[model samples]
Target: MNNGKPAPYDARVITHYGVLGLGFFPQVYYYWYKWLDGRYVGTAARTVVKKLLLDQFVLTPPLLVVFYVSMSVMERKTDLFEECRNKLLPTFKTSCIFWLPAQALNFLWVPPAARVIYVGTCAFAWVNILCWIKRQDY
Candidate 1:
């Protein structure tokens, strides 16, 4: 909702999130977990730290870009980058706050095969946060 108004229902929005949840995110998480599992064989503490670092630095920034851009496109906005330009940093900052500890726990306890599902579970809430951020005027 924007300014306390409910967002108009759009199937594209539903499809966009559905695709992300069913296809894009699962693939990304599976590969990320696989790579982290393969690359970091140190102590669990060290591995979780490394995973969190990569998650916060490498993966999240671009993911936020994608989120904003895709949402803009799905909304049929003329300027795809406007929302991204205005909101990416703040959204990413919020995401860092949310995902850091969540991913740390994911890396620590979630096994390779279940990592995507775990992240999907987390993404349920994260998506709501993203929606809220997207609707904000900043």
Candidate 2:
């Protein structure tokens, strides 16, 4: 609005009903992380960093790719890869800052059974961030 360019609303990944599906991703991924992370409990700091870094480096890239490409499809765009290229870096950097401490809390203190719910709470906020990111005029 300030810049005179209309905010790109429809291209956002977290569209009205799309939020429900995106919410499922974090919960599901949390369960998958719990299973994949297994029972090898390490030093508290080390374990938190491991979980954060793995989630950052491994999970985020693929998810960003999927998110951008899928959002493009939802937008009825022809060039999905272009959408990914336009949004990936800024989104990934912001995601790192946001998710690092969020996941650290989940890994360190949250019980296994509540992990999904814990992350779902954070995901609720993150979707807002994603909406903000996707709507930027970049």
Candidate 3:
């Protein structure tokens, strides 16, 4: 296609799959944790929210964004909007399927240690997604 290069974003198959892969498993695990751990409540719930949205979000996005941008640059292309669009569904699903429920439990019933472990382990999946996004050629 076009001088041995694929369209800037059309063939981003790796990233697409990565998004889906990264999105599902974590939520699945988190909910499982809830069934096992019996949800957190009161102050515990508030604390979990603070950590995930504030701390984890802040910490993870830059690393992930850097990974995404670097991969684009390596491929000699960059389309931030396209990447965002491609990632939207996976991102939304990840939040809905895993995060919302896991967090509800975290805020209402689960303990802080479990919350941290859940977030930390799930982060690896996102990192793998970033790596997939980075390594794609087209």
The best candidate in terms of lDDT:
1
Report the C-alpha lDDT of model 1 over 23-95, residue by residue, as the tens digit: 6767777787788778885447877798899989998888788777877777789999999999988988899
The C-alpha TM-scores of every prediction are 0.85, 0.79, 0.38
Off by over 4 Å in 3: 1-76, 124-138
Candidate 3 Cα deviation (angstroms), residue 102: 1.8
Q: What is candidate 3's lDDT per residue for 1-138, written digit by digit as tens?
A: 499876676557566545544665356445644543444224655556754564335433443444444455545565754564465445544445555555555556546457647565655655555455444443
lDDT of 2 by residue, 1-138 (tens): 459887766535436336544554766586677764684364388777877787889888888888878767777888868868988999999999999889888788887777778877997799779878878977
Task: Order the numbered candidates by lDDT, best leading.
Answer: 1, 2, 3
lDDT (C-alpha) at residue 138 in model 2 = 75
Better of 1 and 2 by lDDT: 1
**Candidate 2's error at 6, in angstroms?**
17
The local distance difference test score of model 3 is 0.51
Where does candidate 2 stray beyond 4 Å? Answer: 1-31, 39-43
Pairs of residues at least 3 apart in sequence or in different chains that clash in candidate 2 = none
- Residue 68 alpha-carbon offset, candidate 2, angstroms: 0.8
Better of 1 and 2 by TM-score: 1
TM-score leader: 1
